[model samples]
Target: MKRLQQLIRYSTFALGLILACSFISERNQAGAVERPWKVRAYIQKHDFLAEALRQETGIPKAIIYAVAGLESDWGRSELAKNANNHFGIKSKPEWRGLEYCKPTQEYNGQQMVTQNDCFRKYPLIRRSYEDFGDFLMQSERYAILKTLEANDYTGWTDAIQNGGYATDPEYAHKLRGIIWRYQLTKLP
Candidate 1:
């Protein structure tokens, strides 16, 4: 009986070691350094954008990060493809007042064709935030967000959902998950 118990203990130790090694190997394979580097670069590029939005709208930087992280994966989203509109906001009829770009698109799997679509661009990151605020403020559907302008992420989430910003049912939960996972509410 003593030998059997010893054998069980050794097996448990080996299993634990294997599990730990597997976890570490998976983390390394996920490109850990690249993940942090991408997030750091995103903040460096758009810190001014967050500041500008804060000045105009009183939204917290953490909330902004949460939104950006979920939408664009710290600006590494495949949707950008290159043009830098990381939020996946498609140009629609409501954006008529904003500037339009002749972006190429393949409709229903056809050849690329030019379409007049609204996109926000800025010579500076500050201007991008200013334009984003303007876009949000101008939309009647987004009026619910106005009440959430000051440091309320739950409110912001509900407002965005109410405004039809995303149909993905998990968007808010995912954003909240990222916010907590990164502890984005904490100081840098």
Candidate 2:
């Protein structure tokens, strides 16, 4: 009788552990499923503005959307939420606007490094979008993007990565993946 009781106790403990592990696994899988939905929702919320900015600035809407989505983590990053900086536009010395400081990681050719960086802040989300458009239009490094056709998202991504817009070596590939995954290339 004593051995049976011990066996039952061990079995119950094992069963509880198994149940807890199963719950954790299910939650993780649910998170994976929910992420694409979040990206889709982010795209839905900002697609019209992306199209408008493209029309006004001559940048491809797909490129704008994919870049913003990737940079901002589907509008869920701290910079996007706190500063409305969807494109991760860092604050330059010449920037006279409000700034938000946060820790960020950048690839420095050798490896990734973390540093506290200041980023531009905007009062409205629209201002963020407008500033991103103006940023591309005014930067000589990105001038090549203007020559690409409006729907050439892959070309724009390559140009942006080549122009040193991001330190990530896989920046262009990641942008292309996002553009393709979300069908952003269909945007006008």
Candidate 3:
């Protein structure tokens, strides 16, 4: 009886350890994709940040939130999780700030391919948002976005893609879909 009890306790401890390890790894790796609820929760949780950033930068709040969803897969990417680089922004020669390099997927004309790239690293989510504002604001390519009405999310989407923010041909459509799905326009 004593031997049987010891064996049962050992099995339980091993099982618990396996479960705990798996949970941590999944969270550290897949994040929202592993837990479906995290995507939705991430969007909702950051709406206010998007709104404030919009007021500060003149980028539409909906566009900011939608881009966060489309760019980072609602904060599931490793950069988003580890570095708070929600926009998939890259390091530029002009930028002398901190950065994080990671593997990422991008459309290479015909198909998607993975490449290791360097992206801006922020210590906090808000810094990422603020930097996103500065990023676009400082770029001449994105200057056209300023002429469009602040609430014109569709136009903003087009401008972002046309400005070469993303290589994916469907970037605008995907961002629009994210906004519609989340009903982000309803946010103040």
For each candidate in turn, the TM-score is 0.60, 0.78, 0.75
Expressed as tens digits, the lDDT of each residue in 1-188 for candidate 1 is 99999999999999999999998889868844323677777877888778778667766777677777776678775434343555546556554433425443423333345565555433443444565566566779877776764657777766765676665656677777766666666524
Q: Give one digit per residue, the lDDT tens place, for model 3 in 1-188.
A: 99999999999999999999999888768632333476558866887788788788888888887888777878987889988999988887876879898787888995999998888888899989998898888889999887899778888999899998988989999999877776677656
In candidate 1, position 55 carries an lDDT of 69
lDDT tens readout by residue for model 2, 1-188: 99999999999999999999999889867753223788779878988888789779988777888889988998999999999999999999989999999999999995999999999999988999999999888899999977888777778888999988889999999999988777776554
Ranking by TM-score: 2, 3, 1
Indicate the worst ten consecutive residues by lDDT in candidate 3: 31-40
Count: clashes, candidate 2 = 0
lDDT against the true structure, per candidate, is 0.64, 0.87, 0.83
Which regions of candidate 1 fall more than 4 Å away from where they truly are?
Answer: 1-35, 78-81, 96-128
Which segments of candidate 2 are over 4 A away from where they belong? 1-35
Model 1, global lDDT? 0.64
Clashing pairs in 3: none
The TM-score obtained by model 3 is: 0.75
